[model samples]
Target chain A: MSARRGAGVALFVIPALLGACSEEERAAAAPAAPAAVASASGTLDLELRDSLEIGLELLEDGSLRARVRAPRGFAVAADGAELSGVGRLVELRESEGTLYTARFSGAPVGGGPCGAEPVSLALSLHRRGDNAFVAGSLTPYCGADRWHGRPARTPLRLTGELPALAAPR
Target chain B: MSPPHRAPLGLAGAALVASALASSPAAAQEKFALAVFHFNAQYVAGGTLGFTLLPDPELDLDDPTTEDRIVTESLDPVLELYERHPSWGVDIEMQAYLLDVLGERHPAVLDRLRRMAKSGQLDVVSFHYSDQLFIAYPEEDWLRSQALAAETFARWDVPLGRSVFCQEGQAGRGLAARMVTAGYRTLMWPKNLLSYQRSEFDTDPFPLYRLGDAWMVPGGRSMDVTAGSTNISVRWTFMDDGELLATNDMNPYFPELFRHDPASVAAYEAEVAALEADGYVVSTVDDYVTHLETRITPREAPPLLDGTWQPGSTRAVAKWLGGKGLWPEERDAHVRSLDAAARRELVAAETAATAAGLDARERLDSAWRLLFLAEVSDASGINPFRGEMEYGLAHATEALRIASDTLAEAREALGLAGLAVDPESDAVTLATGADPLRGAAVAEAPLAIEVHAGDRATDTSWELVATGHHRVAIRFGAGDERQLWVGFPGDAAAPLVTTLALADSTPVSFDRAGFDFEEFWMALPVGLLSVGTDRFVIKDQATAHLAARIERGSGDVVFEDQTAPIGETATWVFHVFEGSAVDAVALAGRVNSHRRIER
Candidate 1:
């Protein structure tokens, strides 16, 4: 019975893989297709709905490092640009071709509109070919009551792929 | 031999009865012993969540894989003991998290556990979903932990007994009411060394005690109290969880320690055989309770003291609070900040979800689960690793984010989006008309607040932030090194000062003309302070990690912010109302600006 179940699973998976391969082939044949970016050696930009962009770097060990540009009024809202932190890759799922979904939990870092209360960033992105679509939000902490006027999560979204830069050494 | 006649008798009478029973052969045969085995596998290598079977060479026994292996291996000896002595009943008190691991790694072990419980050989007990420090977090977190434990138990089809055990025996004065509210009938607290030393009741007889009312009825019987009422009582049974046995060169109570040691196991088996040979009925707490007679202690029995197993004193909880470098002041501040954030977000999210009639139950449950996991006591107590604290902070942050997002969605659904309250302007209404403390003779004065550190006293100026109706909000700057206190003018006579206990919210009062200042100070673990005559309720801002106490010298209630960072300002709301202290607490929760999300 176990062997029969294995065969049944194989029967279901083969066609799915072939269909995915066909989709990849058709995408490659398309005139306007952008080259697939290597999972290694490049940075991914996650832009939220509010146009707050977070830069993500996938490391050699499958962990992630993230950075966000500080907004005005933040203590570290420096002219120097970004605050960075190492994070753990919470989840990663791949579905044939270049399609994948990734979620990472970043360490709390100071900056943003939340001031000294370190804000943790959780980035979720769906990758298709060169661009990975991003949807992100920020929750203010220092004190819960301090964020009354602020939306529970300041929303962010990433629309299209940006040029990939060399990964941080 | 038939059981001896049981009656409720005073301490003297009970001592006399005990003496008489010691000489009686029939009573000698009625000796009962209960053995409880606690199993926990929350300690993971690198403080990561989840279970694994691959052992880390560095962590050795402390590794999650090894911990699970040890627990699984320890079950064999327990099962053998049950098989060797079928008539004997024992308890396997486990954390719900351990049960989850068992289901995942060793399903057969769970099957065996279920069989033993079903066959009446074992009673399955739990100490919340995870081993959370009940006194450190909010009451809502406690309730959610128990609810999650129940869900885990149901999923495994395990029969959870009526009794609950406190992890590390870290119980408090307020726990009894909370446990009663949570639908538990019996509590098996193995470490009552402090209670035993202070109380008149002798431990030799091991009489069953009741909480909410200070009385011990000599009986092997249990009584059911009205469920959900804070005043309800529960049976308290004390057990010797191997600490006593280890002193006598017997096997230790923790299974992982003794399971692999043949000599220790033999010694434990011999000890059990000796008890049996001595005519003692060794069984589970549930079974042991059925065989005892009732001997009531005095009506003026001492209240149940709060502490943990270690140190065996009322001040044991302070070990977790600070000192010994176990939990530093800085970590305490961070964890407390996260705790306040998670709590307020959860409350607001739930309230908004209800108002908007949103069916986001799954999201809310997830948020609560993360918060409860974050509040596990292991993160701060004992020899806590830095990784554990980080794990807690991460989970807490995620939980806060989920709850905050849920609140936003609920508000949007209710057509209340973009509605906001300026904390600076929206002051709560203060009560007027007459002084509620008129009969108590406590005179209201201006904000005469002082910051005290050692011998130095600094009179801090306050800013009246807002005033409305019966509420007045005052803000003052406090240094990390000093103690912040708010004073009221009163005579030398001490008025009744009452406040809800830290975690459980049971009404705790302090009112002795010259009570020991240290004792009075230790009692008020939470921030809210209410004076006599139902007059004034002084509450600090929800985020502050302040310990409030009635100053012995001046009769003033002081809120000490020991964990406040440098340059931090504390805001306190003074509420005047005519109601009980419990009502004042409820009103404080309702009227606090932090609790409101204006539309």
Candidate 2:
């Protein structure tokens, strides 16, 4: 997507704020990628100029789609999600690259969301044509932000004690 | 010809006056039909955990400064605050209802809003749930939040009929897709000043929003022989959906009295007067819907867009925070706070809802709603960061200053005044005497504030701001939307004004276009409302236009004394990157370059 002078909050997910805040001058879209997901929740500092976690919704065919995890929804970027067809949005929280899990309730766009109890499901991801997609057709069972390494990286399970790290600042 | 008919003329005039008053439009008074709807939700930016925050005040400490960190990544200070305060939801509404401070939760302080809606005193739109963080949660959470919000609104008499996030610049729109899915013909958001086609351009923080259908004229086409017609659902591809950035939300969101000084108040009122004069209506989301339905034809559409976050704003401030070399750990502390606060509220709201007769299903829905939208409110996460950094640690330790304060005085004042409520009260206090810090974080401080920058910070090509508290304004400018930060604090209860000092010239050219440079004074006293690192794009005019920084002016310049009410308070906070004093700063204001701005 095009990069503008954006800043504040998580610059990687919804890079739009930084683009909007850019006081320098206008320019074309810039190919900036989301940063790596930090496993430690106690203190992981980042900004607009930093990297962001790219969410992927893998498909049966092996193609990929991407989307930006905005403050509101999976704001679809030029990069689509890894999943295709009717896979649901899941929280792949994890701790230091340990047990990776997938939690899904419903697909993006249509249908109601997953039920309560942050469901946990086993899943994984792979890249395709510059895009990362989530792969799986599993039924969700939990709803909490199960994976906990970093709120940045997608398709992972949460594990660290992210009290203030994951709550509100 | 006058003596005999004088009585009749007086009667005729009286009748005319009465008729005019009668037809003055029921919206003239404080009619419920003319309400101001606002979405008070805490919104997270597009990034996730592990992302680095731009800059923070806490990092202005020792030798080396570190970069790339989240603003709310630490909680040691906040936890310490809890140890000091000990009472969380004591004198405020746990759910953040404004009335909580006045003590009304138990039986209900008669929930004036509910009363208003029931008694036809409001065209109000209630919240999705409690403390819902917008944009960060999963998609299902968004749906559950919407349904829960609808349910809550139903209980409050403000049904979740349409999507009404009439807050400053943030709202939980996880339901945007759902709303479209649910088939809302005319969804609305804040439409600041940008007016053009029926594109889904995000709205600025204007007081009101106008809605119209973008995809109209769906065809029920069959074999075009001779069959009649039938209505068919037609969803067209959204035309304008690239990136819309709008800025300049100072006056629209904050009240004039917020600044606790002078300059900011003047800027605020100038905008208000213009809006009032322009006949801009301060209607609620429902009314906005009605207006478009009535005024806008199927062929017409209002600027339609979502994504109510401004990036280009607070330029000077952001740079300032970004360059901190002092307290390196402050950034870490700040980011930790965000997460902690979110979790805190998450836990609190959930526990409370579950504790209060809410079923597992309802509790889940409400919890999701809180995370999805209500959490995005000032009563949620943003303000807590403000309490963390005071003008200087100026008073408390860097980590604890702005984040929390000593509430002994605040609680006493409120309690004595019969304004403070029990923490267990039905109200959810946003900024109260109990938790003076953390904004939505809730601390035991005497004063606290949260900024609702109106709709001025929505999608736009340029910057536009709503002049005052509750009005819409249009700005005629160029491209690359500027920045917008809400800082209005004082309202009609205490209006603010600005006074530009006349140069030490003779006779002082009365009402002249220009004057020599000397000093400018703007008054606002909302010290608590300041988001330290948030730089604002302040524009004020004067022929001599003073310097940029806002320090007390010691230089003596000539003055012109006139007999008009000059608004009290020069409470503007300017960012003078290089200037040593604000008295020496300059300006780029128009109309009121020297023209008196009154609110």
TM-score of chain B of each: 0.70, 0.31
lDDT per residue for candidate 2 within B1-599, as digits (tens), equals 00111112122122323433443443332111111223221221221222225433443221011101110111111112212322110001012222221122222332433433332223333333433333322233334544554555545443233333323332222233344454332333323212211112222212222222222111111111111121111111111110100112221112121112234334433443343344332222333333333222333323221223221231111212111222222221122222222222233333333333333343233223323422233322222232122111111111111111111123233333212212223332223333211113112212121222222222211111221111111121222222222222222221111221111111101111121212222211101111122112222211111112121222111111110011110111121111111211222111111111100
- Consecutive 10-residue window with the lowest summed lDDT within model 2 chain A: A91-100
TM value for model 2: 0.29
Those runs of model 2 whose alpha carbons end farther than 4 Å from true positions after fitting are A1-169, B1-108, B131-133, B136-138, B156-163, B166-168, B171-177, B180-188, B192-285, B295-305, B309-599
Taking the tens digit of each residue's C-alpha lDDT, what string does model 1 give over B141-213?
Answer: 6677888898898999887765556666654556655555555545554344333334333332334555552
Q: How many residue pairs clash in each candidate?
A: 21, 215
DockQ metric for all predictions: 0.03, 0.01
Per-model TM-score versus the true fold: 0.60, 0.29
**Chain A only: TM-score per candidate:** 0.37, 0.24
Question: By DockQ, who's the top model here?
Answer: 1
Q: How much lDDT does each candidate structure score?
A: 0.45, 0.23
Predicted candidate 2, C-alpha RMSD = 28.1
Scored by TM-score, the top model is 1
Per-residue lDDT of B137 in model 1: 50
